[model samples]
Target: MKAGTPDLATLGHRIRHFRGERGLTLDQLGELVGLAGSQLSLIENGKREPKLSTLDALAAALDVQLADLLAREAPSPRAALELELGRAQASPLYQSLGLPPVRPGRGITDETLAAIVGLHRELQRRASEAIATPEEARRANTDLRERMRARDNHLPDIEELAEEQVRASGHRSGALTHREVSVMAERLGFKLIYVDDLPDSTRSITDLANGRIYLPPASIPGGHGLRSMALQAMGHRLLGHQPPASYDEFLWQRLQINYFAAACLMPQEASVAFLSQAKKEKRLAIEDFRDAFGVTHEAAALRFTNLATVHLDMTLHFLRVNGDGALLKGYENDGLPLPTDVTGSIEGQWVCKRWRARRAFEETNRTTENYQYTDTPAGTFWCATQTGRTDATEFSITVGVPFNQAKWFRGRETTVRAESRCPDESCCRRAPDPLAERWAGQAWPSARLHAHVLSPLPSGTFPGVDDAEVYAFLEAHAGK
Candidate 1:
């Protein structure tokens, strides 16, 4: 055994230890790392070298320093992504990172990123093959784990499944209908609730990453209408099989996943590059972002709020509101009385006023909106701008970016930009199964986790299906 190597045997023990300390099971950890347990187990067994991003995720999920992943004299091949951190180390602050997980998702050349993405594609491809043996899958893993593992765990209990799917949909923003997403979640024991769907004023799964499902006293459709979730909605995520032991541990797990998604979606280099460019441009322009990247305005705008200490910058805030014009999640940087992880509320009168005005307000004075550092999660950020807007629709960006080198003290508010976000809602519909999507031509490494969000390796081809029919839906959607 080598001095610092996080060898397979000990690695598994340590991993299991860390996971237990956090009170997360293999399934929960996989969800945090955006992977399935089998694939993760294979990694634990040292059967495969984690792609750099996956390794970074494991670090975050485990709350270990990136370097602590192993004591190897040299880093894993995935370490290639770490090339720049050495340069980043010029400052004493970022130097002793100890291989802590820093998100390494996007910056690789499209080719390199594509290569890493190919690993996911292969993973997906293989899962598609296994979907055929649905029964065999159930026997291999725990109930909830099996459901997630199968990714095809659709069952007859539609309503129950929808609730579960809604909860999982919270894993991301833009949730779909309860009816639609439920089918997906129930099969897996996911729990989802809605407050009011109308401006979607409620707890957002995208906001919390991993937490309980919040159900409003009144559904969006009203007392007697369809199930609807609304504003100020908040809840804890049901870990399906493995329940967390402590509250802090649960919150920690949630933060880890939130960070993981951010890391995976935006690679380190590209993120900095983007900030620098945004700095040069003064603010990020929304339309340019959407057309350029094929993203919805809400996703783009929300991306702004997701910005945290991963980079340096002045903090910004988003005002989550209720239909009645009351504030649910307050507007504050990572500072002041603002929440460290959850959203706060505004006076109900504010809601009425806003509804009357039919507009949004930028709170500048600390009197109405200012939070202290402790008020936010560790590594809080500030100074970001809006980026999702189009000719008609608009999304509000909430996260902050690192401050500009020439930044100065002044008015706290800026329009920055608006993005015309795409309205495509999140779907765990489980229709045709994710296996179908791979056959239909999904983008590799798309944060969405294609057909094979489960299974183990990228082996086994979906033998019987013809490639042409496999991609029919995608082709049709692409049809002119």
Candidate 2:
């Protein structure tokens, strides 16, 4: 075969393995299938395509169904689409659909071809529109992230609105008080209700008809947490977003609200000023930023990425990972390499344990920020990580800068160094020979596989929103 050409290397290996498992030589298999040894070998080695009759004969010889011979890793989407289109043109269904027959090496009229393609496109569109999965959600999220990157992750309109709200409330210089946030919601025609038990799947829910925003108690205590939730809920009303039609719209809407909330909590002028001073003094610490603004570490890290990348001429990577090491969220305006699967999602991939983000989970003191120096294929980076635990899981909030840009951060002084060769087995999955000889299987902690990797994403608007509950609530308040 020509180099770099498509071939059935995996199928050839499977055929050889199955043949060996059956304790039969190629000649014996050829004899059973009534084919010469050379022809059978060519088929086994993917040098030639087999006819359906030959495949059926081979299946019978192997005591398996015809479908079993063809089932394996699926082809790419474009390849699969082409294959389906080719099959459809020759199918009886095409004739039933009143479409003209398509013959190989023959040209059809342009109008007829257009009609067939239009019909196929409509069917594929309808199929995609019906159900939503986690994969779909991730794809949607990735798409939105790319859009944001194109704009450098800055939204001037939303930021201006948030800053105006902050300045009007007279809290631009300090943390927005709970009373101030409640009053702001009241002014925006929203009533806030705090509950002790909220569904694990949701942090807050908005009753649009009743103008009531419900929040869980866990989200109520923090100076920033409750306020952020309230602002996000109010933001939807102020921003005039309609009900989302797809998972992509749902994520984009949620992201818009989150950005509005962050901007409200950390106003533009004051935040940029504070960050600028910190950079000049070489005192840019995430915890200090959190304490100064009375926000969570995650919130501070997010705001840092927003402002630093735009105004301060700094590039950074922000990451959030669970204790089990699955990346919950990540972004890099810098050119640092982030691991992504073939579909370009980083959410459920495991982070290298040697990296500060994953290693923070092992610390005895989660409050103390962990710092480390790391070398990656991209370059050397200095990272700062802080851990936060909730009722559900422990998460590490991490911020990292390239080695050249690390001097402005306090964590740059760390002497610790580790190397990461991730997105590969040698990094975390397999052990080095020296460690394998010592304590590889004996004392190493087994990483927990996150279910998000396997869990199907929700179909439709909001994963678990109940239309029936909404109707019931509306009816209950009808007479009130």
Candidate 3:
């Protein structure tokens, strides 16, 4: 009997799709097979058949069973996903690669859930080994820099960079309004859900060892900016990184990227300058800036928060836009501890003054009256103060910037006073509730952007805020 006359060429075609779905371009797979891409294409399309040794080599390169490589055709979505993910895992792009796959049954597990946490920890033994060190990162950075140069050479326009940034941040264009963040999540298939919907002290956001992703909602009273932020953050974690085993680290990363995203969207000198002109003339109120600069109020306020830079003295400089809820962005310090009550809504006041007042009082300015915050319906904040007994009483210059960079944080967060602190004790309160004051509105973080949505983990879930347990788990996975 003749050895099965397998359509050896068709078998090669099957392998090609597997590699493609795994996100390997033809060149990459062909290199593995010791042939140029054109040669592989000829084989895959059935013009020729690879030798038995060649086929085996291809299977080894792809990490697939040779028979399966020969047999698979039009693989399932999950299979295709595995290929795409495998590519990401093995790609030289990520600084640190292969975050522990999310476990099944994931929605942020509690630390004390009485667990396989020990096993989970042991699993991390190999994970740290995979951490992308600075040395490994150098190559990726070089590659990125080369790509960036190529981008500049090809496009060379600021707007083009904006579009590219939007794409990489995992969002689409044509709907980049104040609400586009939610739209992006919707596109990704996530839903806007309430924190109450999740168990208390849940992982909140994470990746499971089994490969699912979960994130909190994007809507909250006045949380539009945060919603925008969470859209990218959840999208990113949903993409390359995993939730940090540590909350401080996790939140810090979130804060860093959120700031970076803002910088990307409304990029430097230009972005802040537009904000400055708007604030100086009071033309960019939350509703107003949307139409003017075509950005969200949260973004405007974020610019305002940068005003609290240590570079400036008690002379407070803030770029107050607006936002609300539990996003944890409004507080000048990411290190500030959060309250358990989870106060979810602050009215539409700017976020810079609360911290400015803290700095002002720390700078020897007398705390004044308890004022009902005009920005919100919540408690009072340090609104303003007299520079001296003789300074103009009505206006403490409404917190103006220096004529040049003298008062700016690298020339950012251009802000002006909406109002000075009222001397009436009833109008201004010296003590500001960091959490309550940080809040600017009550909108829920938007539901997950469908485009940003992801499947839940059914395998191992994230450990709760327990440090040691999570550390051990991370250590175990790191070792793995």
The true-versus-predicted C-alpha distance at residue 432 of model 1, in Å, is: 59
Please tell me which model should have the higher lDDT, number 2 or number 3: 2
lDDT of each: 0.38, 0.76, 0.41
List model 2 lDDT by residue over 1-480, tens digit each: 334322453344445555666888989999998988888788765567777687788778877665656655323333333334565665554554686744322265545555666677675564355356667777887888788877677888999989877766656467878877887787777878886544555667787777778786744456577889889988888789887766677778888999999998888888899889989988789998888778988998998888887898888899999888888899887766776777798887788888999888888987768999899877888889999989998899999988988888887788889998776678877978898899855886778775765777543345556545545654664455
TM-score of 3: 0.30
Q: How close is candidate 1 to the true structure, as a TM-score?
A: 0.26
lDDT of 2: 0.76
The stretch of ten residues in a row with the least summed lDDT in candidate 1 is 419-428
What tens-digit string does per-residue lDDT give for candidate 3 at 1-480? 115434544455477667876788879988877989998888765578778788798889888887776663434433333333333334343324455543323243433222334444444533432343333333333343234323321222333443445555454332244445544444455533333233334444332342322334545444444545545544454335565543333433454455544544454445445556654554433233333444554454444444323212212222222122112222323212112122222112223343332233234434331111222222222232222222322112112222232222221332422333333222344445675577646446866443312422111223223444444543443333
- Top model number, lDDT: 2
Model 1 segments more than 4 A misplaced: 1-242, 246-251, 286-294, 305-310, 328-331, 334-358, 361-480
On the 0 to 100 scale, the lDDT of residue 266 in model 2 is 80
Deviation (Å) of 305 in candidate 3: 6.2
RMSD per candidate (Å) reads 28.1, 13.2, 23.7
